[model samples]
Target: MGVIVDEQVLTCSIPPARFFKAFFVDSNNLFPKILPTVFKSIEYTEGNGGPGSIKLLSFQEGSGADVMKHRIEEMDEANLVYKFKIIEGPKMGVLDFESVSSVNKVEGAADGGCILKSVVTYNTKGDNQNAIQETIKKAKEGFVGFFQATVGHLQSNPDAYN
Candidate 1:
């Protein structure tokens, strides 16, 4: 497998706790409702639906559903970090690959808000290591869409975010 590396930063004006809780901590239930265009549905296929749990995300309506499927490989609720593995779908080479996602909290500007940065490390099916640029671009676009939708939704309805 050929590893593909990419990083994207998303900053939200809302408080970190609010954005974090809504997006990361409680996203499985809230994301589908907030952004159906990019999130058709998220279902827990294994584990306790918490740390070490694995869930399935299909993108028929969410994010075009062309990139990939995910499996949560690890979780750390206290630190607000989790890892997910790519199980299937069309990303990188032939999609038969392994990837882990790490979510790290970033210190924002003087204006306090949550800056959640997710770095995904992935690989392709073949040994050629091709498609790195395209794969990275696609991942960045998908993540940007997610963050934009989330920030817009929260801004429109502040009370809901709380």
Candidate 2:
């Protein structure tokens, strides 16, 4: 199998604690309410919201309306770090990958905003590596979009999540 790894740092104007609370802590319920167009719902199929938990992310009606199942590999609330792996989903079809894992570390930036360090790894079946890169690109875009929408929602209604 072939492996593809990528690391990216994304900056946002939202504070680290608030962003993590809304995006990671309360996402299971808040995501669908805030961004129903992108996520239909997020449910826990196994465990709770901690490590080893499995979440099924159902997408809204769109081009590829498929549910992606992910298992939480690690979570550190104190450090604002989270890691998970896609155990099942159409995303696995991108490069016939055996597995796709992502690690996200959120830290407070000097500007009072936050910086997200994202690392994505893809384990493919063969030497075909082009699609692996494309998949990572799409994943990064999705993460950015999710954060942007969450920030927008929080901005419009300051007390919505707090």
Best by lDDT: 2
Worst 10 residues of 1 by lDDT: 91-100
Instruction: Work out the TM-score per prediction.
Output: 0.79, 0.89
Per-residue C-alpha lDDT of model 1 across residues 1-162, encoded as one tens digit per residue: 666566777777888767766776667887788777776777777775666666777566434455345666655655656667666666523553544455555445468877777777765565544455665677688678777777888898889757
What overall lDDT goes with each candidate model?
A: 0.66, 0.83
RMSD of 2: 2.0
What value does the lDDT take at residue 19 in candidate 1?
77
Steric clash count of candidate 2: 0
Question: Which pairs of residues have clashing backbones in candidate 2?
Answer: none
